[model samples]
Target: LFICIDHVGLAVPDLDEAVKFHTEVLGWRELHREVNEEQGVAEAMMGTGDQLAENARIQLIAPLNEDSTIAKFLAKNGQGIQQMAYRVADLDHVSAVLRERGMRLLYPEARRGTSGSRINFVHPKDARGVLLELVELPKEAEEH
Candidate 1:
């Protein structure tokens, strides 16, 4: 079953600049930054507050190549909400249900995601016009 909102992604022009702006100027902690070539994006994760508390995350996304979706998104709509991620128990099962409903997926199947989790994206058209991401964390990652 679907669980929780993992984090909201924001498309940015530059990952480094956004990281600097959030950390130096706003005083947030840089939790992690990594490039997922398969996704064609460079991502930066910023922690707004302690994890023990109700803290949100700032995810800055920048295109790694000109052909990237984020690149096209910036060219068309400018920097803004990229996608919303939702945690899930079994992505495979959800995929079957979505397929049975004729919903389209951005990825053919789930793939390794940031922080070593598994993720898949549903098309905006099928997700009520909001790009939705389904994520399943690795067992080891979840144990922590």
Candidate 2:
């Protein structure tokens, strides 16, 4: 089951510039930053209010390699929103149900995500043209 929107992912041509704009222009504070070699992305999470709160942030994703998915997205669509991530209470169960209902998952198996969560994406075509990411945070990270 879905809990709430975790963050909206924006594919950016340059991570530093994006982060600067969000922080200086929009007044959002950078909460976290990481480079995932496997995913071929360098991302920074920006939040306006409480950094620890769920659904209060945006993730700026920049390609770490030219051949990465973000790079392809930028080439096709330019820098913009790439995906909407939703936090789920039970990722495995949700994934199973989606499969049973004939939905296409980008990563069929759950993979490590930012903040140590298990995550997978529902293909854009299967999700009505919106790339949707499903994230299941660790028990301790859940909002009370």
Candidate 3:
């Protein structure tokens, strides 16, 4: 159903501070940064070293406004790990199989994700309280 852990999402109150800490203290390098208006988030994708293609990354997400889910999460639980993403070769097929197994997906259709990957989420309740995201990297983005 999945290839590997794509990236772990962290909800932060401040994106710059988190990125700074991750880069300076934790030694993670910032690979990408963007504001997803549709999702009401400003995120930074951090990688460990040279292998950006295969390495597991950490996504630091901060709320763009109070209406953002990240803001709500922070208000309720403070800053921390928010979601776990699993990489898939075929998101549509995997989503279908998961649905057949009685998993409740959060979206009816896949949405755009970091680096133009297709993504969808499994309901937190269905995944035992951890928000599970499934990501299918674009074909040309895959490491050969």
RMSD of each: 1.9, 1.4, 1.1
TM-score (C-alpha, index-matched) for candidate 1: 0.89
Better of 2 and 3 by TM-score: 3
TM-score of every candidate relative to the true structure: 0.89, 0.94, 0.96
Please report, in order, the local distance difference test score of every candidate based on alpha carbons: 0.85, 0.90, 0.92
Task: Estimate the TM-score for candidate 2.
Answer: 0.94
Mark the 10 consecutive residues where model 1 has the least summed lDDT: 49-58
Cα error, candidate 3, residue 18 (Å): 0.4
Tens-place lDDT per residue, model 2, 61-138, is 999999999999999999999999998988999999998898898885899999788999898999999999999987
Displacement of the residue 17 alpha carbon in candidate 3, Å: 0.4
Residue 68 alpha-carbon offset, candidate 3, angstroms: 0.8
The list of candidate 1 runs beyond 4 A from truth reads 50-55
How do the residues 1-144 of candidate 1 rate in per-residue lDDT, one tens digit apiece?
687787789999999898898889999788888999988999987777666135577678999999999999999999989899887878889877887899898878799888888999889999898998888877775644
Evaluated against the true structure, the overall lDDT of model 3 is: 0.92
Stretches of candidate 2 off by over 4 Å are: none
Instruction: Please give the clash total of every predicted structure, in order.
Output: 0, 0, 0
Tens digits of per-residue lDDT for model 3, 1-144: 888899999999999999999999999999899998878999999987657565669999999999999999999999999999999999999999999999999889999888888999999999999999999988877764
